[model samples]
Target: MATLNGSPVGLADMQALALTNYGHFTTMVVEDGAVRGLALHLDRLVGDCRTVFGAELDPEWVRECVRREVSGCAGRRTVRVTVFCPGLDLTAPDLEARPCVLVTTRPTGGVAGPLRVQRRTYHRDAPTVKHVALYGQIRLRRAARLAGFDDVLFAGADGLVSEGCTWNIGFVDAAGSVVWPEADVLPGVTMRLLRSAHGRHVTAPVTDGLLRSMRAAFATNTAIGVQSVAAVDDVVFRTDDPVVTALREAYAGVPLERL
Candidate 1:
């Protein structure tokens, strides 16, 4: 049985509920009782909720709810907190702030190795907001896994690379230039920090060939701070490459709690 808005809700029940309710949702995964980038995630949730739902939420109430839910976790584990806008009938929308749904300590498989990525053509606006409507991403991930690639990288209709199915993408070129997708991709919290601290060292929309030299690349998400990419189709990136090593070390130097 799953949970929705603090009430017991089975997966089937939630799916049925969502079919009738048209709104947004945010999911944050916390590990070891520590939620990486919790503040940023909450801010995004609130901002997105207001944008999509057109009503402000009580941050203190939401924070208290999250605290209560997280306190239920056991050891070093993963917990998912979901804030959903259940009903949005413009004619008569529900303006209340519903309880956040908390699912305690669920297994997320083991830590994954560096990913092999395949490029596709798709782009999303407002990538930072976590929404419940993710069928397109879900389908792409399934197709990628079946093709033996760990994940899929999407390019905008204009041919600019956006991001991976679930994370932000960053690359390193032969000349050791660190390149990242422009703002068209999700502004990941980890990516934001790396950019702010090392802005002068990074490049955006780097030359096309740079993708080939890609001495190193990584994807960032809330669950994983910075994960190296093993390959892009047949092209391989060395984890020990000097540039890759330096970036990894820099990322490690940042307090994990800060992220």
Candidate 2:
């Protein structure tokens, strides 16, 4: 089921979403009715709504709606909450922008195995807000898969690895520290939670060459907590490294919040 402005909506609401696909959104994987980093997800909607639509969305209201929508699920479910203006004029943007929340739920249990990625020089706009400007990313990911890879990793013009199409990239440095790239990337909820669990994290600019020299690496996201990366455009990584195993266990140790 899907909802629009806290009310039940169907295909018409989806059509409106596609027509005005100019909003910020966030997705969380709720397992047995609990989510990790629930506050972070809500805070993301609040901050992004203000930045995109010039108005703030009440976090409590959105939280309540999300909980109500996914209340009856049995197992793991993917919940996507979007904030948008229904009657926004794209031609003449104004300050009187009021946004509402739309929540959609679906069952999910897919496993993201060790990923093989292809690097590409692509820049994303407003990397903080998770908006619907994802056609380019989806296309690139599809092309990567067709070309015998798992997904695409975005790199800067300076060859600094930023992030994946939909996941935050992490690495295990020579000193066995979790190194988070200090690039303009969407600080993902999973990565944030991982950092909280593992405090020995270093924020540094990681170039492609530096990444190749790393001990092990993995990708993090809400859907798949931590998945190892086998290779990134021919530079193979230690998929079964002890550091990767430690990260997986550390991330799994994070507690989930109810709704």
Candidate 3:
């Protein structure tokens, strides 16, 4: 289901996104009228709206739109809240910005994980914001899948690991500390939630050379809360890692906020 500002989305409303594709979005897992890190997701929407549209977004209104879309959903739902200017013009893009909220929901079941990912050197435009310009990520992910991998792990030209195609990458060191790569990737809500709940994480530079010193790796996102990484190219990590188990538990234990 899709809605624009609590109303049904129409073809005209989607034209701007298809033509310009200038917007920011946050995806979250909504279950039983509650969400983990709901505040973070809302904050991301508000901040990214200001960055992309030079306007303000009401988080409470966004929440209400989301609630309207998923009010009667059963089981689990994946909700995407996109902030965009539906009337945006490419030639005269500086017109007074009027950002609109587009909310969409889809039924979600089990999470796929223990991913075998391949490393690729690439970066995204406006890496700090979760924007809709995802050509680079989609291209690299497709290439990785065609090359016999489940997904792509992105790194910089300097060989420092950053993140996955659509998730944040985390490592478990020998000392069982959670290691987040210090890169210009998007600050994922799931990553932030895990860091707060686990309380034993550090931000550091992660490179291919440092993978040997790490014990295990995992992927964090709204869909798959914490998924083990079986391999990153030739380097394989233990899927039954205890640290990963603890992380999953910790993520599950985080209190859910009601909408």
**Worst ten in a row by lDDT for model 1:** 97-106
Measured by TM-score, the strongest candidate is 3
Q: Please, what is the TM-score per model?
A: 0.80, 0.95, 0.98
Q: Mark the regions of model 3 whose C-alpha exceeds 4 Å error after superposition.
A: none
Clashes of each: 1, 0, 0
Q: Which residue ranges in model 2 land beyond 4 Å of their true spot?
A: none
How far residue 158's Cα lies from its native spot in candidate 3, in Å, is 0.4
Clashing pairs in 1: 37-259
lDDT (10s digit) by residue, model 1, range 1-259: 2455445656664553466444454445555555545676667667866765666766556555555555656544444555554443345455564434434435544547788998777766456666656778878888988998998988776666778988888887777777887646656766766665552456466334657767788887656657889887777888666665665566545543411
Ranking by lDDT: 3, 2, 1
Best by lDDT: 3
Candidate 1 TM-score over all chains jointly? 0.80
Instruction: Give lDDT: candidate 2, residue 158.
Output: 90
| Global lDDT of model 2 | 0.86
**Deviation in angstroms for 11 in model 2?**
4.0
Worst lDDT window (10 residues) for model 2?
A: 86-95
TM-score of 3: 0.98
Looking at candidate 3, what is the lDDT of residue 34?
A: 96
